[model samples]
Target: MSDSTAYTESAKILLLEDDLLLAMDMEDYLLDRGHEVVGPFGRLVDALDAIPRNELAGAVVDLNLHGELSFPVIEELQARSVPIIVCTGYAELPEVKTRLQGLPLLPKPWTAHKLSSLMEETFGATQEPRDAPPSKIRN
Candidate 1:
């Protein structure tokens, strides 16, 4: 595992992904980078439920959870002002383009280095883990 001393601060990051192996990979990578992993939620409902329960510095959301679209989860995160990174294997559909107009889209099959770079760019440098104050999710 890589050393965590490189970061100045750590963050609690929510992860919404349906693929078990991929989720694990991402969770491990984030943890290795010294950030707390909230959930590798495989279902949309679970991801939605997690939003209000944890204070997240950012989120990595897959465009689809199982067969269901994850737009609601994305919207909720946006409403809360939480930064987000969307990943998808499918082509950029019109809806995706519309919903994620300015948000970062991490295409599938990305490397850990790419993820690490993006995470840093999105959430800033990682640091030692710290407890975050509770935050509420807006309706």
Candidate 2:
């Protein structure tokens, strides 16, 4: 996976997960796959603010962030038609099922392979710029 040829057009992806360790790992994986990451934002407010500022092609979102439901973040992304892949441990929550019907949902403890594959399917081919470092939106 060192080569970027297999990735979809280099797209900016929003990462909304609260766990520091998990977010770091995901950021590394997305960067390795040639996608610019907007933020591994721990707070929903931070992620929501970054959304309007970046041109996000897709997202990997967590259902709960530090105990708060992230429905507003999901809805904002939905309104923009940016593809989303929900990555959370709380997938069984009724609100998750009700609001995010039909979207891809990858449970917690997922592999980098599963995440990348879904991203590829959603965004098509990842573009080159192989040497470019992945970017992040800091707030």
Clashes of each: 2, 8
2-117: candidate 1 lDDT, tens digit per residue: 12213234567888888999998877777766676778788888888988777778889999776788899988988877788898876378866887888877889868776767
Q: How accurate is candidate 2 locally (lDDT)?
A: 0.77
What lDDT tens digits, residue by residue, belong to model 2 across residues 1-139?
1122233456778899999999999888778667778888999889999987877778899888888988899889888788888987777779768777887887889786677677767666353335666555564
- Flag clash pairs in model 1: 7-126, 9-127
By summed lDDT, the worst window of 10 consecutive residues in model 2 runs over 1-10
Worst 10 residues of 1 by lDDT: 1-10
Q: Which stretches of candidate 2 lie over 4 Å from their true place?
A: 1-8, 125-132
Residue 37 deviation, candidate 1, in Å?
Answer: 0.6
